[model samples]
Target: MAERILIVDDAAFMRMMVKDILTKNGYEIAGEAENGQQAVDMYQEQKPDLVTLDITMPEKDGIQALKEIKGKDPEANIIMCSAMGQQAMVVDAIQAGAKDFIVKPFQADRVIEAIQKALS
Candidate 1:
């Protein structure tokens, strides 16, 4: 079965980009969220195999959402999404239990590689 993924991003365009990339690569989209708060809510409701989370968002950041999800499901597979020069946030995400991360303006191969590595 295709792995289910929850896509979380504040921007509609970003979400669409990710969804396009993921679906084309044979991954099922379990759900989508526009902010960190929504992300946490969707995490519990959908319980997708993996999550692609944006670092900066309204109502709560990715790191905070990641923590909340992890608190609920320690085995959750979360991949933080960041932009250039957000190394500090990325590190925080890693320390907070994210399985891996993807940078924005995403490359199809890099995103797939990260997801594969995380799943493996």
Candidate 2:
């Protein structure tokens, strides 16, 4: 079965971009969330194979969500997404147990590479 990925981003455009890339690459989309709270909630419900979590969002930020999710499922596969100059949060996310991270204005190859690396 194709790996199911939960995509979390505040921008609908960003979510759509990621969904396009993943679907084209043959991955399944388990769900999409626009905020950290929804990301956390959906994670519990979907139990997807992986997650692409955006760093900045309303309600809560990605690092917090990453920590929360990691607290619940240490083995959960999560990849952080961020725009440029959010290096500090990216570091925090990595420390919090995100499997990897992809920068915004995402390159399809890089996105696929990160997901593949995380899933592997």
Candidate 3:
């Protein structure tokens, strides 16, 4: 079965872009959130197989959301997304239990690769 994925980004366009790519590649879009707080809520409701999370967002940011999710479910699969130059945050995300990360202005292959690696 296709993996169910939740996408969390404050920008609707970003979420749409990711949804387009993942759907085209046969992944199921389980849900979407415009902020970290919403992401956490949706996660509990959906329990998706994976989540693509933006590091910068209003109402809590991705790192905080990641922490909340990981705290709730240690095995939660998440891939952090950020623009270039957020290395420190990326490292912090990894330390916080994110399985992998993808840079913004996303490349489809890169996103897929990260998700696959995280799932594996």
Count of backbone clashes for each model? 0, 0, 0
Q: Candidate 2: global Cα-lDDT?
A: 0.97
Q: In candidate 1, residue 15 scores what lDDT?
A: 95
Candidate models: Cα lDDT each? 0.95, 0.97, 0.97
TM-scores for all candidates: the values are 0.98, 0.99, 0.98
- Which ranges of candidate 3 are over 4 A from the true structure? none
Candidate 2 residue-wise lDDT, 93-117, digit = tens: 9999999999999999999999999
Q: Quote model 1's TM-score.
A: 0.98
Q: Which residue pairs in candidate 1 have backbone atoms (N, alpha carbon, C) closer than 3 angstroms, thus clashing?
A: none
Clashing pairs in 3: none
Where does candidate 2 stray beyond 4 Å? none
Judged by whole-model lDDT over C-alpha atoms, candidate 3 comes out at: 0.97
| Per-residue lDDT of model 1, residues 1-117, tens digit only | 999999999999999999999999999999999999999999899989999999999999999999999999999999999999999999999999998888888999999999999
Model 2 TM-score, 2 decimals:
0.99
lDDT (10s digit) by residue, model 3, range 1-120: 999999999999999999999999999999999999999999999999999999999999999999999999999999999999999999999999999999989999999999889999
In Å, residue 15's CA in model 3 sits off its true spot by 0.5
